[model samples]
Target: MSKLFSITLSLLLLFQSFNLDMIDVAQLDDFLIHAQFHKQKYGDNLFVFISKHYGELKTQHDLEHREEQKDHEELPFNHQTCSHFSAAFVLSGADFTIPKTPQLADTLSNFFYQESYCHMENSDIFQPPKVA
Candidate 1:
């Protein structure tokens, strides 16, 4: 059961890290070709162009807007004909809490003994002779 759970979790993370739902193979190829041609398009000894208009998904994002920044969807979708994304995998699991062990007595002698009184002043509690 634990192994199955681990495998399931691993697959989930794998899909998320790769952005499986956001991928289109043909689009990726087109984006790469377009990126290669960016030098000719910009025409300015440009080592890099980090503008929001350069590289981005040309499709509208319906779900990537909930938790993520809306600017991802707000960027110009016509600048690039295909989706351009970066691969990222983040593994963070350093915050774990260790349970404390219970304190226990080493032996049965923890409590001294069950206190019992055999002697009585009137000696009528049992109404008979009592042995020490």
Candidate 2:
């Protein structure tokens, strides 16, 4: 095989191994509900995707701490933001969906990059120059 093809095959195997602990269907349903809420509240400003439950907890906690420190004297937390579980959003539709595994991060990032480019009228970011 060519070097590029070998590299691609290696990456595919790595990703498959990484996604072993995929979120269950029920977890996905819950995540979808929460993601929908986030979308409605934050509009297009937020990125929706599945993340490791433990990984996001630390992040969520840090955000809370920052908010609390910002209001030093006040109680700070008036609402709950983090959930006990983790999930991935069904990007294309309700029926066809995949777990939000770490392996999908690169793909999701690329999709979002393209989407942002479209909104900014700069879709050329991913395009190649036309042949003469």
Candidate 3:
């Protein structure tokens, strides 16, 4: 196989391993509800990272729909958004404690951001574009 083909095949297999098809509307809804609970309990900054990324996902989806000549309706959540939200939820802890202070909230936000960043950095699908 050519080097480019080999690399593409490896990346495709790595992406398939993520099993994004397992995400469903029901699961996404549940995550949103839980996110709302966390937002209220832990304050807005607690989920700042997830919310920012969610907005980006929405924008991308809108652009995609526009390109396809379709009306843009808000999607509940896609695999990428679901995965990010799930990661943030777990990083924040399954057994939740409301962060009572700004410092605590900041700490949680930082943790979520760092974890998500590292995950993307390590993923073949998220690698930075190569320079010519």
Candidate 4:
């Protein structure tokens, strides 16, 4: 992706997350109720109705954020280090042992020299079938 696209997408998601955090369903319900109240009281048109809804929403948000700013200002916090840093490490104690295996000279160790001797009586008995 291009750098500009990446930055724009990141910023869009960030601002959208903040917007989602600030707005709530209950707050929207309150806005709707107030809009209806204003419409009924003043018999305002669509323009006035939309204006009042967003106007109240922005005003309430501003007031809430202002209070938050004031609260943050009252805190006696600075960028100074508040606590000491601590670090710990342990030495690894690993022991490896390789077992020694005896190697065979040949893979076919099971096969050995066999005697090819056969009895003459056994060979005579192994004749072909004869016709009657």
TM-score, ranked from best to worst: 4, 1, 2, 3
Error of 1 at 128 (Å): 42
**Candidate 3: which pairs clash?**
none
The CA lDDT at 27 in model 3 is 67
Expressed as tens digits, the lDDT of each residue in 12-126 for candidate 3 is 7886666534344436665566456546765645356255336655465346446422211222344344334333333644667787855444443433333434555678787
Q: Residue-wise lDDT of candidate 4 within 1-132, one digit each (tens)?
A: 699999999998986665443334335555556556656866876566564334455455346456444422322221133456899986678666699899868756777889977686567567877889
Q: Candidate 1: TM-score?
A: 0.26
| Deviation of model 1 at 86, angstroms | 31
Off by over 4 Å in 2: 1-16, 44-62, 65-132
Provide the TM-score for each candidate, comma-separated. Answer: 0.26, 0.24, 0.22, 0.26
Error of 3 at 76 (Å): 13
> Cα deviation in Å at residue 13, candidate 3?
7.6
Ranking by lDDT: 4, 3, 1, 2
Q: Rate the local accuracy (lDDT) of all candidates.
A: 0.50, 0.47, 0.52, 0.55
Q: Candidate 2, residue 66: CA error in Å?
A: 11
| Per-model C-alpha RMSD | 16.9, 33.1, 33.9, 15.1
> Ten consecutive residues with minimal summed lDDT in candidate 4?
71-80
